[model samples]
Target: MDLLEEYRRATMFFESGDPGGAARLLEPIVAAEPENASVRQLLARAYFASAQLVRAEEQLRALLEIDPSDHYAHHVLGRTLERQGRPEEALGSLRIAAAMRPDNDDYRAALRRVEARTGGRPR
Candidate 1:
């Protein structure tokens, strides 16, 4: 299949609650287009959804290395870290995401949750 077709199928799988399938379809695309931030983001999301937190963290960190200002990457990485029982580490990433996109309620909520867990005031 073509890249677009594969991407579409992977998205469909992800949206249909089959994240493992999505990850399978996206892995090759990610390998083939290592610099494609969008693809990497989707693959990272797929990994996260599939409970592959380690891979998700790796991909998100790589994406952040490529684009430090990516609010979504920070937010997702925060959530991933939280899921891994690392709320303290999650706080910094969530805070950065919330600060970057102050209007985003989801980001704010995530930041607040992490802050509360770490005994920090939610600003």
Candidate 2:
């Protein structure tokens, strides 16, 4: 199958609550295309679903290094940071994600949660 098809299959697995399966499918794709931000992002999502926070963070960080303006990477990193009890950092990343895609409710919600936890507005 093509890259997009493989990506779609991985996404379907993730949405179906089979993140381990998704991760298994995405591993080779990521290894084969290390520079593909989209594949890395999908692998990060799978890792997050499996509660592999460290791996997820690593993937997101790598994606950010490749493209700092990636909204999804910012969003995932924010979520991972929040889970790791770094509300301040989470807020910063979520705010960047919200700014990158103001219409995305997930980023906005994460930003709001971090704000509430920190008792401060976006910085």
TM-score leader: 1
Error of 1 at 75 (Å): 0.3
If scored against the real structure, what TM-score would every candidate get?
0.94, 0.84
Tell me which residue pairs clash in candidate 2. none
Off by over 4 Å in 1: 121-123
lDDT of 1 at 54: 100
Each candidate: what lDDT?
Answer: 0.93, 0.89
Candidate 2: regions farther than 4 A off: 1-9, 121-123
